[model samples]
Target: MDNKKDFLKQIMNDTGKGIKGYMKAQVTLMIITFIILGIGLTIIGAKHPILISAGIAILDIIPVLGAGIVMIPWAVINFIIGNKDMGADLATLYVILVILRQFIEPKIVGKEIGVRPLYTFIATILGSIILGPIGIILGPLAAVIISSIMKTKKKTDNRR
Candidate 1:
């Protein structure tokens, strides 16, 4: 029926918007990570800090591979080379990066997708518990889709 078609169309549109917004949030996070890593690496006297930070930032966004993929190995290499101070510094920087991402990701994603940070955080945690690693991505996406459906339904009801 036309009503069903319209409803589906509205849901799609809203969900699309939310997905795009989520992508924007991701880019914002990537930029923030790059800046922080660049500064921290430079402070720690790492060679080619900007380049390394950029690479790590890009990797951090990829599924199953994160900043730690490179940073942890690099830190271990430093340790093996007897550069204990550099290894310690790298480890500390990695921890800071992880903490900051955990703190800010939900807030940024929720704001972009029109959900509250608390809801986003809850969804992420639940998703991770239920669905495993992929749930972190899927949980927020599911929230966005559900939110779109609710908003569209509300608008349709209000029009009646």
Candidate 2:
């Protein structure tokens, strides 16, 4: 039916927009992460801070691998090697990164996707709980799709 086709088309278009928004949000987050890590590493007097921060930022984007993956182990090694101050600094930076990401990710992603940050946050948490790491991606995606569907339905209803 023409109505069905129109509905599908609308949904598809909105989904594409949502995907674009999501990608933008991710890139923004990645850049922010990179800058923060770069600054922190430099302050900590780490050699090759830019390169290391870039690597960790890339890893942070990948599921189940994050700045902590490199940072925590490196910190522990520093402690083992009798560099307690460096270890403490790394640990502190890692905690700061974790806390900041938790707060910022949802806000940025939600703003781009045109959803409330709370919704995105809830979706992220629920998705992580139910589906594990990949849920972080899937949850926002599901929210975007559902939001598009509701919008499409409302438009159609208004026309009728």
Candidate 3:
């Protein structure tokens, strides 16, 4: 029927618009996340510049463990080399990084996922548990999708 065709066309248009909006939001959030992460890493590097920078860069790819993975090893190396002062400083920097990761990273990730803080935490844990490192990335994405579905359903119900 002509009406059915028109409805389908309208739906396609709306979907296109939504996809565009979502992509824009994602890019914006990614930029913000990078900025925040850069600032945090910069602060960590202020004291033990070389070690922290190298560690953070190396762990950049890993999901939850991230820079902590690199930083811990770097600290151990420092200790083994008999640089106790540097090792202690690196340890302090690692602690800062961990705190930032636990408290701040979630907030940044939540903004990117467009989900609530609680949901983000739950998704991260559930996702990591089921999927390992990859799960961390997928978890937030899935949460966003689920949230979007719920929101659309609510809108439809309201109209009805």
For candidate 2, the 10 contiguous residues with the lowest summed lDDT are 59-68
Candidate 2 accuracy as lDDT: 0.89
Of 1 and 3, the candidate ahead on lDDT is 1
What ranges in model 2 sit over 4 Å off? Answer: none
Query: lDDT, candidate 2, residue 150?
Result: 95
* TM-score for all models, in order of appearance: 0.92, 0.95, 0.68
Q: Please report the candidate that would top TM-score against the real structure.
A: 2
lDDT of 1 by residue, 31-90 (tens): 999999999999999999999999999988864457889989999999999999999999
Worst 10 residues of 3 by lDDT: 28-37
lDDT tens digits by residue: candidate 2, 15-120: 8888899889988888988999999999999999999999888888875567778999999999999999999999999999989988999899999987789989
lDDT of each: 0.89, 0.89, 0.63
Off by over 4 Å in 3: 1-58
lDDT of 3 at 111: 61
Model 2 clashing residue pairs (backbone): none
